[model samples]
Target: MELLKKNIHMNRQKSQAVMQVTLEEDFNVPDSKADVGSIIQDEAGVKIEDMKVANGQVMVTGAMEVEVLYVADNKERKVHRLTERLPFEEQINMEGAETGDNVQLKWDIEDLSVSLINSRKLSTRALLTFSAAVEEIYDVSAAVEIHGDGEISSLSKNLDMLQLTVQKKDILRIKDEITLASNKPNIQEVLWKSIQLRGTDIRILDGQLDVKGEFFIFVLYAGDDENGTMQWVETALPFAGTVDCSGCSPSMVDDVELSVASVSLEPRPDYDGEERILALEIVLDLDIKLYEEDKVEILEDVYSPAKELKPVTMQQVYESLVMKNFAKCRSSERVRMENNQPRMLQICHSRGDVKIDDTQVVENGLKVEGAVFADILYITSDDTLPFALMHGVVPFSHVIEVPGIDGTCRYSLKTQLEQLSTTMIDSEELEVKVGINLNALVVRVHKEDCIVDMEEAQLDMKKLAELPGIVGYIVQPGDSLWSIAKQYYTTPDRICRLNNLESEDVQAGNKLIIMKTVEITD
Candidate 1:
């Protein structure tokens, strides 16, 4: 007789690779632009054009857009904007990769530097990091129940499997006509504009996802004033979007990411010159990942009462995205000088970069250590009105107390600068503070054992007649009713009824009477 067995199927697939590269480029100023004097603001955006896999390697082709706002060296102190697009192609080693695999890539600028080469040329350098994750879907038909004349013993555990329900990409466009305040100047030349996604609120209902978020728009514009002075203004834009995810349930987990692909800005046509109005257009890329959890009982081991059975067992480990945590870390650093310290006049621009140094998984959560680098440009306390640059580094450490995390889990951490500011503490000192956000996604791999197949073994039929129908047995350590009944060729229900036991749990050193039944095969 064949033993009846059950099996469980895993629900998730995940793999990741990370690599870093330094990018450098030399760009000439536009034909009509003046030479660069001091760089004010620098921004970069990355777009993946194509990706493919062959011979255990992943080929990635993408472009990085770099925009710099700088002051000209002319007598007028003109402000100019220069933009360039640089393409890159690289191969990353990914074991077991093949064609048509689903791959997602994320690009990050870790550090950047802009140097003035001449009045009409500039050099740009940046340290970039690319991370890619590939997930493959598998459909496994698990056996739920066994059908045969044999006894089946199994071990099982509950798993919150991550089942991919929906994967889709869409474009979200934001159009708005914003009017400047009465005290501000009219838009002459738009120097630079940056968009930051501050927060997101999501709701899932009836296979649909509703998304709402806040976008902060910072614009630096040169006024129509006689001196052509430049100033910066900020505004908030509220946006809403929807995603269709059919066959998805409300109990499932959702992971959504939004990125700015491109942006366009123009002065409104009906500008009255009193309250300056500008038209803003922004394109956003959206991605949705949904996961559904399932529980299944797997048959681990089996045996037969009338024969000796050899069961084939197999074990495998699977990985899944467990949870993502969003947190903010704030730190401040002070730069001091004893003498000849440049006094602060006004800060032109300020930005920061944060790097994750280490992550230690403890009993409850993770202890994260990192450092923040701040760059500030200011019209300093010096002659000839030269722009002075100051840099500061601050070290930070934070404890993320998330419960239920163990040694078997791994995590990925990403940090971004939210805001940076500087305050002059005295004529010889300045305080720099930065606010950064950390997004940590945890992934877990679990192991399970399953009984694949079984074989029948020979048994002694003459010994069955000499065995007693009822016997007294003493419970030993780690003894259970199922184990005792399976050994005596009886069921747990019959053993409980015969002994008049209140429950299936029995203590050690207890005496119980067992009734046995022997099965005969044809």
Candidate 2:
């Protein structure tokens, strides 16, 4: 055991540490010299050397600067609508993400936009800029819902490390469904009242301000067509779009304003066999922004350091892939049981991490006294079978841009996956929720509906045999059915029926037990 030394806190502060980097001067430009077939020299009709030369080096170096951003997340530590917020979140969901899925993150602009090149000097660039008004947002809105049961893991309970991950590829379908759940009901009356008062045309959009514990929302409003008098309602419906101003002219209308409400995401499981996916939905409240005024959307643009701005890294590429997957994701995944046959299973998971004050021998186990952030990323898949379909290489890497530590400003990347938690959280909440029921899938495999059978069935028997409300038996080193019957609660006949015991002698290693949860009353 590596004895505990002075512990170092990983995520102890939120200070934006700045470092001065000297730019290097020299650079080697790629030689563009190409082979050129030579024509006979005008006089000397001899085979001559090919001559095709390219441009020489042109130094375009300068002090390109950047900042770093790093935040942590655990899928299991789900914050509700009113929960406290983090500055930033480095969440990379492989399957996809839903609207209102709070993306908490800390902006590490320094690292992300600087120090990518090997040297400090600047180089030439075929710079390209995009300065065109987006033609249109043909389709501006969509909703996603992931369904799966979240099993408690031991580490999560004791260590409080929670995580969950959903893969983008597992998203079955990305459908476009528009639902007008409820209206203010008094909107029409308010608009008519404004028209009666002789108001002009109406307009709407969201208004954002840096308010603690506050976010933006949208509302409805109306104005008179003749007099240009503007009026709005006190009540608003949460929607997910900006009020169209193209329809209203600026020559007549002054604009409008209304209250805004914040929105968030919530996930829950629906276990109806009729519905293959876990049960939950994403609700987008669009009518939260005050749109009537001339509002400017802030696109944070910071000049990056020469090193931070470079081609995409594997991590970034993976993140983009997951984002694409989640964007096109449907509610759930369908696992193939019998070749073409599919079955549903639970696929919910959550993950979290912490920066302990002191270094320890093993991960997860807390020392006598430790200071930790316990930041978590709570994630849930759309369904049992869909989550099971998620498969890919999950690994970790490091770069100076997203460095593990920065003076007082340190950054750490984390993945909070509850469904595929190969690395136990080492906490109680995690250990209790680490198991899932693949019995349907198992049955399908046995019935020849599934192509492959379960191999290397590795699980803690203590946690495996007795699933929540289910029941089973433990294999003693040298015990038989008759001895077990005399030792405990049930009788020999009951044990025989419970475990499918054939003969008087029972195997010690294999636990023979009946599961109550898997049993059907009907």
Best model number under lDDT = 1
Model 2 lDDT per residue over 422-461, tens place:
2223221222212111100000000001111111222334
Q: What's the residue-level lDDT of 374 in candidate 1?
A: 66
Measured against the true structure, the TM-scores of the candidates, in listed sequence, are: 0.85, 0.14
Model 1 lDDT per residue over 1-522, tens place:
444444334534456788888889998998888878877567788878888887678898888889887767777666688988888998888776778766667778867777888878888888889877766666543334455665544434455555566666667777887788778778788887767665566677787777787776767788888866666777778888766768767787666666778788886545344437878887877766666666555554454554666666566665566676878878888976435446667765555667778899987777889887765656666543444556678888887766767898866665666666788776556788877777776767777555566666676565655556799999999998878877776666677888898898898998889876675444
Q: List the residue pairs that clash in candidate 1.
A: 35-119
Clashes of 1: 1
How much is the lDDT of residue 244 in candidate 1?
71
Which residue segments of model 2 deviate by more than 4 Å? 1-522
Please give the distance, in angstroms, between residue 348's alpha carbon in candidate 1 and its true position after superposition: 4.8
Error of 1 at 68 (Å): 2.6
